[model samples]
Target: MAKKKAVGQRGSWFATVDGIELPCAHRRWAKKNWPHYHDPFKPTENGPSASKILKYVQAIKDEKQVILTNDDEHLDDEGELTGFTRLNYIAIYGVENVSFDPDAGLKFTITKRLVELR
Candidate 1:
């Protein structure tokens, strides 16, 4: 089990959980395949879907049983969320579907799934 980093260190670099480490490879993948606008934190309809996000959330629950709730309800002037992507990076994979294994990453699938749901 990979121990959680002490706040804002390398955790910002890769996705780590239960001592398992999934690094920038995942983030880079999400960036390349995901839509140009899809941001995780401030998840907009333009970004990933609640279902896809739900997958990640489920994964986290499976691994550590942690719960992540949306704290912000306001969008930006242009209508963007606080940052992008919830659960942070290192801890993101725990959210589930953060990676797709082959083509496309979690964000892309989530964004697409969100569109389909809509």
Candidate 2:
């Protein structure tokens, strides 16, 4: 029998937009909750495409700033980080590039420009 593939064995993809290391999995919650902003990727299915993600990044970058926070902060009354809630606002920067690794998944790099921490 063929050896079974491990979970996330194929790894993931990451994109660095406006100096933020945005992992492909980072916006999972947004993908499900806010389809307008987040578009999930599933290489195995007809899911998000690279250009689509790039567009999203560009849109966010155009904002010139954004608020970011830990996914845990979106927990529901049941103490589960499921559903939508106010996202912690974090400073924004510039994009560098997006990378992929078969073992490590996706990796992103941010711009070298300095961004004030709020």
Candidate 3:
């Protein structure tokens, strides 16, 4: 028989986004693929990005609901939030899709799998 991993021990970090909770690893995966976005010397800078993303998500959860897909518009054409910032957002808030409204603010679509049922 194979040994089973302890609950919460083997899984990646998770955060709540739009009432749904998801693993942070997914965002980390995206960031890992984009090496240039990260500061090689100061890796810890990426840590706070997650919290920022969560704050963004939490503020809009009631109106935006859930995150569904990834889009290029999530970041600026110059690539703000495209690398580590984007990764942190995805990991902490489950915001798969992002858009900006000049009059409003950042708009997002989130994952549904881990939604918290009322």
Candidate 4:
């Protein structure tokens, strides 16, 4: 059975999905929400999986160019069509705090910060 309470402040609930405890806004929202799915491995809990659909993003900061990559697929917003075979680094960002819906496979978003090299 699902539990409901009006006490406390708004956005407060514990998720009990498949015997796994996850905190969320609505407790009942996870009930049979994801039909057949498994939680991804967290960086802290487990190392980044190589099979993930994530790539790298290259950028320069303070004359020191660096390549950063995360465990999530990302899009390039920059309008520069730089050569892909150049000797430059890359960067990557991930969509955080993603929630799953039974019918919906996976849903998440990513926000990137850009700094031009002058």
Query: What's the TM-score of each model vs. the native?
Result: 0.28, 0.30, 0.20, 0.19
Give lDDT tens digits, candidate 2, residues 1-118.
2221112112233334445543223444333443222322325344456675565455444443233322333454877444333233232334344434333433334443234333
Tens-digit lDDT track for model 4 on 14-50? 2222343222221112223422222332233233333
Q: After TM-score superposition, what is the CA distance of residue 69 in candidate 1 from its true location, in Å?
A: 12
In model 3, where do residues sit more than 4 Å from their true spots?
1-44, 49-51, 71-118
lDDT for model 4 comes to: 0.25
* Model 4: colliding residue pairs: 33-102, 57-90, 57-91, 58-89, 58-90, 58-91, 68-92
Output the worst ten-in-a-row residue range by lDDT, candidate 3.
35-44
Give lDDT per model, in order: 0.34, 0.37, 0.35, 0.25
lDDT of 1 by residue, 1-118 (tens): 4435412233133243446533222333244554321233433456556565556544533453222212223457986443433333332322333333223323323222110000
Ranking of all candidate structures by their lDDT, best first: 2, 3, 1, 4
What residue pairs clash in candidate 3, if any at all?
66-109, 66-110, 67-109, 67-110, 68-109, 68-110, 69-96
Compared with the true structure, model 2 gives a TM-score of: 0.30
Worst 10 residues of 4 by lDDT: 56-65
Residue 15 lDDT (model 4)? 24
**Tens digit of per-residue lDDT, candidate 3, span 57-82:** 45444333332222233354875554
